[model samples]
Target: MKTLLIVDDEPRTRQGVKKTLEAWSAGRLRIETAASGVEALEWMEENPTHLIITDVRMPELGGLQMLERMSQAPTKPVVIVISGHAEFEYAHKALQLGVVEYLLKPLDKTKLIHSVEKALELEEDRLRIGRMEKLLDPKLLEAGQVEAKYGQHVRDAIAYIEGHLQDPIGMKQVADHLHMNASYFSVLFKEQTGMTFSDYLTRKRLQRAKELLAQTRMPIWEVAEKIGYQTAKYFIKVFKDSESVSPTQYRQQVSDPEETIK
Candidate 1:
């Protein structure tokens, strides 16, 4: 079951919202509450929730500040901000912070339910896409489907990218090699690959890094350079951002068969 966190300085409001959501969701969601934004952040560090419904004004670390903190986290829950008429400005800032919904005080039960359901739907979609992307075969570049749809130049580009991954390969370089305009090649690449050229290159580099981490005992810095990253620090950052774990952590989890050699 998905978890939901309700944050408010007022104990009565917190419990009332929690109880109402529990009843409306009919136990489909596991609901929790925090008396202050500081307490909510502490809880989030230990437990991740699917959604957070927070009051704007609190004694310490109000809703907006909490969101700014959460943005730095590796994983963040969807947020719904609740504010009064006087806090309209705060609610507007929350919208800019990417709150799924901005709710005015004297909360309407129907509107709350609708917002909660919509957030859940969006979360489900996000999770579904993440799972699908993980399962997608990067090796599909060599498959016949690529050539059938994008014709030979795109296929050749993929082959070139795979062959020259250690080189400084850019869209313009690839386009020049293929005898096509860079702008046209970029658009065509995205249409056929369903991702921008830069994104595709990054994914390829990441995939190679994962393989090297899992199957070799190479120094992390060497692995980074081999995959076209200029520095281990930047490579580690990109790896953690994409995989939610550092390269050392990932390597520790996956046993390397060649680890015994050398």
Candidate 2:
């Protein structure tokens, strides 16, 4: 399900928009509303919202200021800025901040709906690219780069596997990439590496998952998606089976190692 946020200083505008969107896209979207930028940031820290449709003028931290802080976050939500002010300066700044759309107040329901749909689509694409790009992130696999222990072919296979842990990869895919018969490649791989290809792949994915869980504030579903798990429930089961702890528990432990020990 897609998640969206609406931020406005006025309670009426915020709740009115939220109800309207809920009525329109109740099942497809999870809509949240905030009355200030501070509340929005707080919500964002704890929740993984997809799109933020915000009012430009707020009591304390304005929408642009909120977005500026959000830009420094690990994951940024797609944004559509709405304002009652018709000034070009506000629109210019909102666009400069990478807003998907900037519309004057009394937002047209039609335009707002279109902008919301567009932002949601963009967020899906953005997350896919982000996950794919993290496939070969050296930081995630820095400690696992011990290919010298294997033969050249096995080493190459290992590299390929690491770079595609987020993909639907199996021994056959690696074998095909190496231009070798799948059965023969499997035999050679285990002979040289001391571990079966499937085991090795799962180990690496779990290793990557651990790194992300420990080092980043990504949501559990995003972490699972990034490491090739197709669903959050499956990811949670696998992680618990492997580590004897749920992903969230592991993150909490690592986040405060001293407290965990105590």
Candidate 3:
């Protein structure tokens, strides 16, 4: 079972969140509670925790400070920070701490659950990759057989996808760029990358959209358009489907709270 820690000064919040997470995980997690960040760190010294859900403004050794201490460790736990205050400083500090999500309280159950699920999924991917690397030569993995796995057309298609992510390009356009039939290119891409052309393109666009959202205080519509989204509404829906949060919410979780974003 994966270990998860809940840190909050409030007794009710600590118990309530613990219960909600227990119900959501259905016994998949070994959940523990701490009344303060100091207490949390004390317990963590003897335990291995995969995730932490912490309140930002505890009396002594606040969540961010606890995270700063954790950062010096060999491995860092995935963290989700919750605060009653949406002060720019808290959000900014949480982002600097590499928090998985920053939530404003009173917590929404759906949002909390979605955030936890995403954090765990990412942790799983990290651990899986770590294990694979442990079992292989690091240099060989760094050299990456992924390129050797792809055909020249697929590589060119990937290059095209990366270059034209800001453009409203489609599979037909990309296939025509390589002077190949659309149907042939589609099959080749799927066989090579194990993902459909549309899926690959969407993934890349969303990745760029995330970076832009986090790094720049751009409006949602502009961010969407820059990633080939024609409309903000459609982009919001697609982003929420993949990320379990709207673009606005994701931006809120990651961006500078002092700077208002449209």
Candidate 4:
């Protein structure tokens, strides 16, 4: 079971959220509430919370301030901000801080439950990926035995590809960087990663583009530019082919206020 920490100043709001989530979750969740940001921070320090749903306006430390404080912790908790109509700026700032979700006041039960579900899904995905990367690290280190002569070059090339996935990445550029022929480098990369370099790069770009579309109100063209697509039309074609939906529709589906985060 995942633990959730709810932070809000109002007694009725806290009770309402707790009741709603408890009913919606059907007893699958464990929830704790704090009356203010200060209390929330204290609770976090003493307990482990996978997700936090906080009100943006509080008496002492506000939701954003609590988030900033959490940034310094060893394991930062994911946050979702609850804001009223007057605090739109604070909500936007929370989004910029990579908040998992933002809810308006007079919270809809379905939307709140969906946001919680989505946050948990994202958190689980992150943990699973972390575990996979850890397991891969040992195998990557062992690869040094077979490719001892070219190990460093291979590592550098992989690093470069990861760092520059949003840019135009070509076999020629990687080959030139490693002082090898394009054909030779292509074969080497495929042998190492079990996937073609072009395929790997495309997957990385699409992953990033999906994140941007899901989390922001950025236009489709802007998302394409951010993910290294020089033409929006081409980007749309590729995204649709890969995802079975156009970028706009993908965003709409994933960004639904009432949808779960999975």
Candidate 5:
């Protein structure tokens, strides 16, 4: 089932649209309503919906501004703009913002149904295409081929980890990314990499840290943050433990070839 949000300042219009869509959906759609664009945005911060039916004009955060803010979201909902005939010019701008459908005021049931179906269909297509792209990501399939110890699934998981090394990524996140059970992913990861997930992540982060220390002049704390460590002290401790030297010492050694030779 898909969730839809209706945004209108008028209570009658909001509830009317929600009720109509609910009746037509036959449990296929979960309908929600907001009296204004501000309320709609507040609801969206907690619950993301598949589609939004928004009036073009409202006081205190109009529909266009709300759509602008939503553009920065990691996943954006399909939008259908509702406008009075006088607001036809504003509807054109909504189209520029990628509103999927432009609906006129005093909506017809048949047109509303058609637009809703089309928007949902498009949403499904977008999701399917996204999954397919992730599955067929060339870099994901290509990494770790030199050892061939891990299967494609493990390789894909590794790719996700590497790509998101800056984030506070965890084993569960990688497992979810690969669509596997956390425990099962842990076992498979150990079998394929010959190390626990934590160890592998630590090793990778250290490796990245070493590269950055040698290749760039970024501060130690910044490097730690970039490589997913929350604090430089912890990163330095781990680095010393794993390499028998602190990050500073390693950087000095790698940066000065003559000192290393001596």
Candidate 6:
């Protein structure tokens, strides 16, 4: 069962969140609460939690400061921030910090529940992927014989690309990491993955961007930056070239209830 930690100063808010999540979790989750950021941090350090839902304002340490401190922890727990302040600056900073969601106070029960559900789903997906990677690592290592001796190297390259897809990754950089010539590495990557390295990277980035677009109300520019495109124009051009539709159009289409139902 996954553990959830709720951090809020108000007793009413804390009880409200606990009751909501307990119901949403369907008795399959463990719930814990802390009255302030300091207490939350201490509890988190002492106990393992899969998700944290915290308020932006507290008596001692604010949510942003707590988030910054949590970033340095060995286990990176998923975080959702709720604030009464709807200032653009607060939302922007929360997004920049990679928070799963920045919700407004006087929380809508449905929205809050949905956000927690999504965060838990993402956590499960990540754990499953990690397990699959562990199982696949040995097979990849064994595949280097009778084919290309650099097969494992190519696999490493792909893993590296996946991990750093949200950052700038060029063919030359990948080749340098593998200590091989760019021309040879490019050929090897294509032969191994059945797609050009650049294509793979772009596809991965686009997939990630798509998920963010579907799940969050983040601006296109922020989404572009998160997926490693510095220029929103270029990002949109590439996305359109690949999907044959603009990002906004794609998002709208996916978000339409009738279209989704159909």
Best lDDT among the predictions, by candidate number: 3
Tell me the whole-model lDDT of each prediction, alpha carbons only.
Answer: 0.82, 0.81, 0.84, 0.78, 0.81, 0.80
TM-score computed on alpha carbons, candidate 6: 0.53
Best by TM-score: 1
Q: Which ten residues in a row have the lowest lDDT in candidate 2?
A: 253-262
After superposing candidate 6 on the true structure, give the runs of residues whose Cα lies further than 4 Å from its correct spot: 136-262
lDDT of 5 at 184: 98
lDDT value for candidate 5? 0.81
- Clash count, predicted structure 3: 0
Model 2 C-alpha lDDT per residue in residues 48-86, reported as the tens digit of each score: 777899988898899999999887665677899988889
Which stretch of 10 consecutive residues in model 3 shows the poorest summed lDDT? 253-262
Pairwise lDDT winner, candidates 5 and 6: 5
The RMSD of every model to the true structure, in order and in angstroms, is: 11.7, 10.9, 16.8, 15.4, 17.5, 17.7
Clashing pairs in 4: 118-261
2 or 3, greater by lDDT: 3
lDDT tens string, model 5, 1-262? 5789999998878877888888899998889899888899889888758899999889998898999988877678889988776566687789888999888889887899899999989887776555334223232234345446668888887788789888999999899988899999999988887778887787778767877887789999999999999999998999899778888887776665233212
10 residues in a row with least lDDT, candidate 5: 134-143
For model 4, where is the 10-residue window of minimal lDDT?
131-140
lDDT of 1 by residue, 1-262 (tens): 7889999998888998998998998978899999999999888777758889999889978889999987866556878998875566776788788898998889988999999999988877766554344434454454435566676788889889999888878999999999999999999898887888898888889888877876689999999999999899999999999889899987875552112111
Over 1-262, each residue of candidate 3 has an lDDT whose tens digit, in order, gives 7888999999999999999999988999999999999999999888888889999999989999999998888777789999999899989989998998999999999999999999989777766554333234332233235857788898888888888888999999999999999999999888777778898787778777877876688999999899998999999998889778888777666543222111
Model 4 lDDT at residue 247? 87
Q: Which residue ranges in model 4 land beyond 4 Å of their true spot?
A: 86-88, 138-262
